[model samples]
Target: MSGTSEGQGPAGVAVPGSIRPSVTERHNFGRTASELRDYRAAFNAAQLAMAVVDHRGLVISANEALAALLGTRPTELRDRYAADLIDLASDARTWHAYREVLRGRRSRFRCTRRLKHPDGRALWAEVTVSPVPESGTVLLSVADISDRRELRARLRHLQMHDPVTRLPNRTLFFERLTAALESSPYDQGSTGRIGLCYLDLDGFKAVNDTLGHRVGDRLLAAVATRLAECADAGGPGHGGGHLVARLGGDEFAILVEDSTGTEQLADLARSVLAALQEPFDLAGQRLSVSASIGVVERAVSGTSATGLMQAADTTLYWAKEDGKSRWTLFDPERNAHRMTRQALSSMLRPAVERGEFTLEYQPLVGMADGVTRGVEALVRWNHPQFGTLTPNRFVAIAEEDGSIVQLGQWVLRTACRQARQWQLDHPDVPPLFVSVNVAVRQVWDSDLVADVAEILAETGLPAHLLQLELTESAVMGSAGRPLQALQALSDMGVHIAIDDFGTGYSNLAYLSRLPVSVLKLDGTFVRGFQDEAHANPADETIVQALVELAHRLGLTVTAECVETSGQASRLRRIGCDTGQGWLYSRAVGPDRIAEMLGAGPRPQAAAASG
Candidate 1:
């Protein structure tokens, strides 16, 4: 309107047919009448929608194709803003870019836009705007891209959803999870905490294995339908609706955005468990399925998608281990303990090679004379990070990782070498036997018979002077290779003792058949023997019966944890041959054991007992 001429229509927008002649005469000076007419005909015949827009963003002229694309006549489209007709002004960014092109500040602008046709149909158009130099106008072109866009949307749906369950797939679930964690606190309502319920259908594999995948897929679809119904109630506008996704196979996850707290997640998980309890009938095949769910809820500030999922995974494993068909909440303390165990497990094999292990000897004294006769060699880890870790900390880890065999061999060799040295150091006193605990894994995973023979030969310690102690659980039920290994070791003049004697498998009949020479009573039985008034008669009677039975079978009885003189006296009266506990000394270095063996003046026993 600001630059309008006398021939222009109202508001500076030109009439449709009338504007074409002026545009040709003003911009094409050398063109003859025939050439100008030919150009006008060509523009009118073009298939793509075309519009000549003035500097005011009003349509100076619109072609028939352009009018048809907007579902209007050419005459009606003239004197109207082309952006409004094509719905380009609906988007702020696209409108600004179109304005820039109209002002000649930008060379060109192109974008995709959706438009509602007058015929009640939707249209997708690719709009392009480019300025015409010296013409004070711009060329606006649009191409109908509705079909292409529809196809693309279909492909995206397929890519981001599970076909069997008709729910979001793992990729979309991760996308949503990552977005939730990265969202601001204000964007997620009051609390920006995120929660996830990771579920795995228990016994789903059995269904797939027996009934086939067809029934399994149907079951998964039915489960998804139920979960979606639950999610709807727990979804946006309620408790912040949850997103349920099928993460491949029978594993599914429910992501809760803007979670209130653990209580909310707990309720959701319980609801899911209850929903899954009902039996499903798939194509007339009635099947019952239960699920194990791991629920984790926490603030998003310091959390990541992977970290949260890992916690959920660990908790789910705990649920399965604790017995399936249950839901378990994530526990930070338990997770930390597991992480520590993993760290210790990874360091075990390397620790042995690094020589970070040492041995401490606890005196197994004679119950009759109260003199040190033998010592039990206990292994300790001098960890650089954890400091002086007892066997309870790393032994199980080593056993699980199969590093126990290597570590066990080292203990055997070291204890034997020290026992041989003690024999040589004090020739006057009786040679002290060294008891070394052996894990069951050492027998199964390694050549125990050969390793023991080699250790004894290398250290020059007699087999009888180096006792190998196995727990009752490990020594009981011995058969095949394990039984053969024990028999071969016993045949080599070695003393075989069952440690923690009464705790496990207590198969008294199998003892005489085996080549065991000693029984080390578990400390629990000894700890019960306090002063006479506080003593447990049942414990004393059991100990006496065990000792009498061992004597009849030609086996020596060593009572462990002989803390006080009263306990030592009671154990001695029960025919126990040896006592190993604080009653003599805690596990100490070899030099201290030597002092107790009369290499120097004896340190007084703690309770003046064994």
Candidate 2:
């Protein structure tokens, strides 16, 4: 007690002359033997594990709590290195801090350390070491944080994994993908390339609709298990550390680390398909599912996690388009084209407002007399960036985006206006009917008869001279409101022609019930006329039968895509009432149509050879 200047180590060991002792400190240290007994009793009652260690990092003494926490007797803890109790490598920064304490540079140090208890339990300890400077001793305080750490680990697991499939969720997958991409080499070095296989199950929605979501969930779990197994197998070419993640719903992805090349990824894609070939037993129903995969591979540089995922999504759509249960690799050129299409889709509504759309006419010629009876109005988009784009490029997009009705109305009104203009321009000649193509969407969206009546009235064109051309399926499937609309349009003296006939499955019996007047033979039938007069006659025979059937049903037949003289001659011979195609000329503007009308019917040889 007399040698003590300030502070005490474990069990009141005095550090002599560490600091200048005040009179109050000396009086506090000068406790009787009974007071010292009270201090020892309080130390034994403490809950935190504590110890005193000498300058060499050796334990000098310990309390009962310290002994109990280590699962050892208090006497057995004495005379041991304090570093031995707090598990860490010798070269750790905390050890350097410990040296700083011993060198008198630091008064105290605190850090996290792992500890092994005598009973083989692992402990996470928050250890505080305070120096008793002059005595070359330190007081150590340890608190067990194992439960908190365990809870945090559980929470983190829940955050990063899917609840249904227990696979890495999108959040975690993105994190890992970003890390991999950042760490990988710019080129295909030994550090390895990165490959991602993004897959979506085909017909998964059908399973959800039929078997219920419970079955669908079980199916997803089974799929995830198989994918995880495949990834974990990591055989010769599969590489290592592949991450399997459930992106959501029926979609999943595999991140291949250290990927060698596309060949390796291709092998993995095949494995995935092969694995999913087996049936999944879900809710007492055996369900078979297939997947379409988009494979994208690149070196680490110039690619981000989001960009990789976007590329994967784009290629996955391509795989689905190419037919399901297949893999499509990322092609930059195709991706660029698809991006252009998407840009076009976004621009459609504005383009309609911008007046970028225009109509061209293709003459529907009377086959027998070689006279131009009507011109089919074909819509074209004069895109600002891209030149005139054909219907083949943008029609489907308009239909998909619900812009078809708007575009259809525009075409109808414009064609009707053009027809009125033509009649005004040529009152002395026969009225040339202008046919406008009507989309299936345009018919079902609203009252078609009202729209057509309005267009005819607005343009001052007679309904009889304005023919509405619908695809054959639309006519055959017309029902309820659509059927009534078609009947009303027919009653209003608007001619209804079924376009692209024989291309779709048409119920011939329903053709008589429809208010349709003209049927256009699909181009497939006319293309067969290329091989002499007799050789591949299947298409020609089909065309002849369709024409005869139409005639019996009192519907006039028009042949489309008659690009050659032989096709024109065969169509004319088959009794096709009208022929419209490039054989006469490609679709031209209204001025050209007026010129053709002004020229009147040409000679038969001129019609065929021209």
Candidate 3:
């Protein structure tokens, strides 16, 4: 002691280390193991919670930090199982890892876990267990990571949930949906069904437009609460697991795992609609909101989550289209048909660009001479994949996508060029006119007058030789820009015909103002008069009245879809100037039309196929 240096302690107690000889000298002494004990001084004083446990997973010793973490004194922590301290057995993987560590199969492991405090409160701790080198004992370390873990949890919550209503968002809904499908029992052939009710608020934008968005947000929150309660209360087909999630905007969804059947899903949709029918009292404003829900339920095994969502979305559109405040179930057959239409729609623009369109002509004959006087140029899509597609299949899609203008232009140019070629080839005895159909969008969206003038001049065809025909609804009321376009085209010496006349808005008073030259009667009236058996006498009266009305208006009447000479004779008696349909010829290509032109006038067959 005289040779050693030391530091003063409480009550003049002498402490070691300052009183120690050199570390090398201390190790060289007979007390080398005691030097190792001195090395553990820092471990005891460390801020990190630490314990020394035997191979049995029992704590041999604990530091002050460890005792503080467990809300117990260091002496009390001794002899307690580490499993008992941190609730380690709560997770099977961690328990298995613990058993592996005890058996010396693994060297070390690190995990974050919830530890029980003596006060019964929970403390989150990051723990590490490592085997002591050359010793059968194990070293355990713990750190309070509650702050970081809480931050991570908060971030994850924000990411997975909608901010406005705090409902699970699209991402979380998809994740849960995938998990539900994956966990379903598919080995039994018919796995349990999963049902989804996709909801969209009807006329919600009107609320946001009339009342501010703040009120709209509150309304959404109220709606979310109602939906969550409905899910928990088990309304209709609700059999157990139900999750309500906001899919963004005014859209929300309810996912039912292991749904009973379609009847249950329908009941859920009804319950949702009924719930929303009640007016919401938001921000001192009593406002009513109703939702349209699309319900889809299918067996979990064969359907992918994305496929289910797509079907749900399509059915939602149907509900919106059918009216308001209703639920529509998934119709697989209807969905398949709509999917084909959608696929055709997507292909329309590209198909036009690739020049997959062609024209076929159907003859319109002079009723008296039975001589072909004109040809209606009908457009067909020569789709590489779908083969030849008729206008009924692709035309509406073209109009919807606004590709009709280009397609119509292509048809006009092709028809005019073909008509001019006929004149040059025949040096013919009588010139035949070419009629091209026009779309409403083509009339309004493009410079119809300019397009007609350009194609006529480029093809060197007289404007009288080409006729532009539009549907009755498109030409009924001539007003503003559309009326101006029609008048301009008519002024360019172009023949204008009203196609499918009288089917739409038969406001005859407005008809006198149009620049129409011919009234193409719809096939419905003609087919009715095809034979006396199916003919309605009222149809003949209607035809007579239409013909008399057209003649009075200075418009020639052409009866369409005449299938037999008897029907033709009836139309001629009604003073119809011309006739056209498969009764004469199904629309044929340009080369075939030329062949018919050269083969003298082929009289209508005695009983032509209707």
Off by over 4 Å in 3: 1-50, 56-58, 62-96, 99-107, 113-126, 132-136, 141-159, 184-191, 235-240, 601-610
The worst-scoring run of ten residues by lDDT in candidate 3 lies at 601-610
Q: How would you encode candidate 1's per-residue C-alpha lDDT over 45-161 as one tens digit per residue? A: 899899899999999888889888877788898899887888888878988999999888999999988877778898998989999889999999999999999999999999999
TM-score of each: 0.89, 0.78, 0.83
The best candidate in terms of TM-score:
1
Per-model CA lDDT versus the true structure: 0.89, 0.85, 0.86
406: Cα error in model 3, Å: 2.5
**Across residues 70-154, which tens digit of lDDT does each residue of candidate 2 receive?**
8888889888888777763355797889877766689988888777877898888898888875777788889888999999999
Candidate with top lDDT is 1
Query: Candidate 1: minimum summed lDDT over ten consecutive residues — where?
Result: 601-610
Error of 2 at 283 (Å): 9.1
User: What ordering of candidates by lDDT runs from best to worst?
Assistant: 1, 3, 2
lDDT tens digits by residue: candidate 3, 1-610: 4455566543343546445547775445536455566657767788999998898899998998888887878899888899878777888999999878877889998898876667787778898988888778888999988789889999999999998999999899999999988884664543378899999999899989999899989999999988888787674334445989998999999998877789878877888888888988886899888989889998887889889999999999999999979999989899988988888888888887898999999999888877888899999998887799999898888889898998999999999999999878866336679999999899778988899999999999999898889998888865899888888888888989999887998887777888888999999899888676777899999999989998999999898898898898888888999999877888999999898777753444323421
Per-residue lDDT for 167 in model 2?
94
The alpha-carbon deviation from the true structure for residue 320 of candidate 2, after best TM-score superposition, in angstroms, is 5.1
